[model samples]
Target: MPDERTKYAWRKAILAARAQVSVAQHAREAAALAVAAATVAQPGNVVCAYVPMRTEPGDLAMLDALVVGGATVMLPVTGAPGPLSWARYLGPDSLRPARFGLLEPTSQALPPSTVAEASAILVPALGVDRRGVRLGRGAGYYDRSLGAADPDTKLIAVVRDDEFVDELPEEPHDRRMTWALTPGDGLQQLHV
Candidate 1:
């Protein structure tokens, strides 16, 4: 496994690149991602997803698509740097600004173990690799929360097409993604 320093460098470089994407390009990608999200949203399944930050690969429409496809969506509620708490995602109107400039659901928070209810979890990542390693923003919240998910639950990392790379630094505690969803690629299975 690569050291934390290497992982930190990768995060910095990838985030810098994402920051340079044009607004038009970001919107187009987000639209395509929304369509792709619909394909994996099984009816009546609970999908744990997040409200994407401005530079992230998706938009509110992606979560909306999951709901329209008959899936119940749950979004993470930020707290101390630990396993994330979750809340049912009612709709766009249900979100309110929270810490770290993130939009979170206004509903009552569910315990971290509630992640076990999800059949699929759409994880946010700066990048993911062919071997299923995910590069997150260094918060470690997803790493902690994902441990609560059932072993069979599908972990899908949402990123831009080019962000699906050949390799990324992996630590023992970093959970592997079962699949990757990109605007151009739709869904690509990773070796987990």
Candidate 2:
């Protein structure tokens, strides 16, 4: 476990660093790269993306491409510090405001059986590293909830381009990222 103070500082640093990337060309290029990476997803790759919040950015415009390409999409729901409950994408009608200022699915959450079905999961993190250490939103909720990720699941972390780095202070329990996503680059398989 990370010391709370270090975790807080890391989160602040990451958010601040991400703010520097406001150029239209940068954003456009990054989105295009991310979307292209997602489009290459093979069938049976369960894509676990998030509803953006706290300034974490992604290419929402590419969702239809992912759907039309025949890949499965699921989003994480905040639960009682338990296993994450996933729901199949049903478009904008399924979302509602969630605690901690995120959009959550308002419709029916899928069965627990669905959680282990994903082969690729896109997790939201403050930062991630070459070794896959993830700095999340200080809750450890993802670590707790995804304790049961399928062995084949690609536990990828989504962050802005600058957040991908060579190292991060880590703890024994920190979840390792299998992949890291950024706008400039689609997805890079991490060493973890």
Give the total clashing residue pairs for model 2.
Answer: 2
- Each model's backbone clash number: 0, 2
Candidates' lDDT values, in order?
A: 0.93, 0.71
Which pairs of residues clash in candidate 1, taking residues 3 or more apart in a chain or in different chains? Answer: none
Task: Give the per-residue lDDT digits (tens) of candidate 1, residues 1-192.
Answer: 233448888888788889999999999999999999998898999999999998999899999999999999999999998999999999999999999999999999999999999999999999999999999988899999999999999899999998898889889899999999999989888987
Against the true structure, what is each candidate's TM-score? 0.96, 0.84
lDDT of candidate 2 over 47-84, digit per residue (tens): 76677664666655445455666677787777676567
- By summed lDDT, the worst window of 10 consecutive residues in model 2 runs over 57-66
The predictions' CA RMSDs to the true structure, in order, are 2.3, 3.3
